[model samples]
Target: MMSGLSRSCAVGLLAAATLLTATACGSGTADTSAAPGGGKPEVVAAFYPLQWLTEQVGGSDAQVTVLTAPGVEPHDLELGIPQVTEIKSAALTVYVKGVQPAVDDAVDPAKSFDAATAVTTIPAGEHAGEEHAAGEEEHAHEVSYDPHIWLDPSRLATVATKLGERLAAADPAHAQGYRDRAARTAAALGALDQEFAQGLSACRTKTLVTAHEAFGYLADRYRLKQVGITLDPETEPSPTRLSEVAKLARAEGVTTIFTESLVSPKVAEVLASQVGAKTAVLDPLESKPSGDYVSAMRDNLKTLQTALGCTA
Candidate 1:
């Protein structure tokens, strides 16, 4: 019933309002540098491992963006508007559900592969030092299950298979390439698993003392016992707790203290000094983009072998 002129004016106003709303939402200091669009399907990984696996499978067929930066701890990340926008626009998002709550909020569930659901998960801090493992789940703990699935090469190989299927589905033109790449990576991982099993067959000690509960999956995979200094990586241990850990380290005959690359080494240094032990780096492969997961994990295997005195 409205006049054409009036309809034209209404449409103009609606378009202008939409523009304003979009502009407001996307305004100011937004990271547009790695915004995902360049003909190839864009993939966004919640953390580094996903990014690496995607890169390996995607192989010039997809553009990948890793949300967590190198050397930063991913436990307490808050996604800004820029990252949220990136997630929404990405063609495929690969993430471990419950790892980063903010990333969960930003990604469309229907459009993502929640890798936590893709693989088996053990209780978080389940193998952490006895003092911290109370079979309790709290809001502050953030995630119920450990999100460090990538630490286990076999599990990562499994994920790579699933992810390859997803990638082939997304870009059918390069489907064979994705499958081929994934198979190669999966084979390499299988060999790594064999190596861990064989290499760890004759270790003098099987107990692992770690900076946090990050190594539970790796330890569990290789049949090693794990003890962690703290449940939360970012939290500073109270003086009392620190002393207790030192005492426990000595009592348990924990000879090698392991520190995470992302966290400070002070705690490990102090504990090692207390227990008359040496400190080593055991990367969790979460935020470290500079090091690929396989290579870092290989380095971790070497460190474990040396620290645990694995023979043959």
Candidate 2:
């Protein structure tokens, strides 16, 4: 009954309105189980990376929420009332185990919820390397293999596969959708892996020094060296420690000193000054921006490449 252009415009408007309504209601209630008579399945992811992974596997069919926001230190965060409420209401809660011991203390594993996915064990030791200082209480948590398993492309695919299965089991009607999304996410992660391999293959200095020991997993997966980490992940190093690291940096010929956003770079800066090198900020998956998993990994790869002086 209307002109062609007018009809198209009307359809576009209707679609936009529908999308707006859905968005306003929030994507946190997209579970297939939550149909007319069924309730929505709410998902709570502990951190940004996991949240991104779950959302990719669940797509628009499940409502996914991330408790940790950008620039916040996941390991040191404590849950507030709002966050606890969100977790309590979620049908499924996904978290990278051991990365945040504080979280484990806050939530009861048996009583919090019936379905919880602790993706990787805390203090995951798989990639921590053998050089971890002896009798260091700090490394105690690093025993679980590497909580940062998401950094490994192959491992990330495994995670996506697992998440797909879990999501499908939780909501059978959208099982195929979850599977497809997982496959797509896996492919994207594979491409990211290739990019990192190619980009860092020819780095002049493979040794990395950082504010925290967080990069142990990344360095191990990429075959890079981690020279040392600051004593405290959050605090500034003492003058004695700073001088020691500076001497170590110069002795090792380290070109760049890396620090994360959530931690102070004072010690790293001192070390860099002593060694006449530069300082760069690296995100250790403590928090992530709004982009999807692949995009965030790509950004991290770029930062690492620049810091390491990789050719590609």
Candidate 3:
């Protein structure tokens, strides 16, 4: 019943309202907004370890949002639109390069902090000739360096210090707070590193057999040899590889085969039965543990000590 001109005007008004709504929401650019009235910088942590580290370094000065949820495997985390937008809007995104391909793709370089950059990285373990399951080839580690830097308390201490500086640079008003927290976090990690050094100093066996190659940093830090069943938990080890590892395990007197929470225990169980060794849970910490980082790591230390037959 309306005239053409009226209809045109109505369409124009609707378009204008839509545009205004979008403007109110936001754009692709970073948000950089302080949290409510607290003026805390918004930080995005890619996973559990980074989340804990960020919380320690940022303290009251930062509001951290963790991308990976507890008990979820972080290696194949798929980002939703909201998560991508969150990465864009956050003042800083803390992640280790090559851990999650989706996170690596989503983060803006200028607003992101790669934790691996803070420490000297070790070479990734070789998994040549290892056969993968269907649709699991994409999960293979593509980076030259292993991305599990958080396993080493000493290296993680370095990351905490650097993260504090980065946060200080981002939120200058809270620079002192950030620095203080960083120092405290670094000190805590340093103490943990000392504990590990002392506890692992007199182990009867130094061979650490794991389900996945997620503990290279830990092995490097403690001077232990890690024998991984596969490069990735999703990757199925070839029979040849399994037989080779089992032979090595028998020769080296490896009493325990380690499995993680995220990965299935069947592979480890089979390998253990083959080598006449027992299977134990050795958390890689790719996901959040029941306790906080420190507690979980302490638990890990205990597990390692027992498995290795450490005197201290």
Candidate 4:
């Protein structure tokens, strides 16, 4: 199996190819021809989750495309020339500000498009002040706020609302259509939130040991505890740290070791073997998924319910 970084790079290349092919076939929305009867606006999203959400809000009245593809890690994604061309051609663009810095770098801030909605994450204050400390680093590339904001149902609602409003402004002809879709999507998100609350409410264990700190928002929302994996999301963990985590899991009766989809499961597997626990893959929205936000959260909730042994 490829390491997490290699997998990310491979996925990025695949996305680049797909976008280029679409452009080459003349099937992309970049065509300058006005919409049929000049109806429905065109919107582009930086990644899959946002693309799904835009579709929900825009309904049949809008055309939406996600720059990233399934299984591709969004954090490490780079926009190819074709992808940049797509963004520049869209009527409106929706994206998470900190999650995909490459797209951010490619977009021009000075030019006024029909609309540009970037979801600003909850201040690190929401995460107990971890943001500033993480922000001080001077790297060659721009560091972003944890782009996992969509993991929280409430945050997803906020993002959808903002995107809906932007879409309405861009295409007044479809304002009602966008509004209706947003309402439905928000309601669906609320229902999903209740499922998580009810399903995980009575777990015998509240503390979750995971592959990274990606679960901070989920943990906070559900009032569960989190112990990070040996490695940060970006790098491998040291052997000593892995050993320590295994020891802690054994002592704490951590029945499930949570791994993510984009990362190699070796570290989690090793830890699980040492602790006599099972490993479960929890998605952190680092990659594109086959389904929309609600569907993804449902899968995640089912995994958490099983891992935590929730009674409901």
Q: What is the overall TM-score of model 4 with all chains considered together? A: 0.77
Q: Clashing residue pairs, candidate 3? A: none
Question: Can you write out model 1's per-residue Cα lDDT over 177-296, one digit (the tens) per residue?
Answer: 899998988898899898888888898788888888787788889898887777757555556666777787777677899997778999889878878999998888877645677777
C-alpha lDDT of candidate 1 relative to the true structure? 0.78
User: For candidate 2, what is the TM-score?
Assistant: 0.75
Ranking of predictions according to TM-score: 3, 1, 4, 2
Q: Candidate 2: lDDT of 142? A: 34
How many clashes in each candidate? 1, 14, 0, 0
Candidate 4: tens digits of C-alpha lDDT, residues 137-230: 4222533344466777766776677677777777776688888888888888778788888888998788788887677667777988877763
Q: Considering summed lDDT, which 10 consecutive residues are worst modelled in model 2? A: 110-119
Off by over 4 Å in 4: 1-39, 109-144, 230-232
User: Candidates 2 and 4: which is better by lDDT?
Assistant: 4
TM-score of each: 0.82, 0.75, 0.89, 0.77
Query: In candidate 3, what are the lDDT values of residues 37-151, reduced to their tens digit?
Result: 2455678999999999999998877888899999899987999998998788778999998889999989999999999999999988766454634324565545789899999
Full-model lDDT for every candidate: 0.78, 0.68, 0.87, 0.70
CA error at residue 72 for candidate 2, angstroms: 2.0
Candidate with better TM-score, 1 vs 2: 1
Whole-model lDDT, model 2 = 0.68
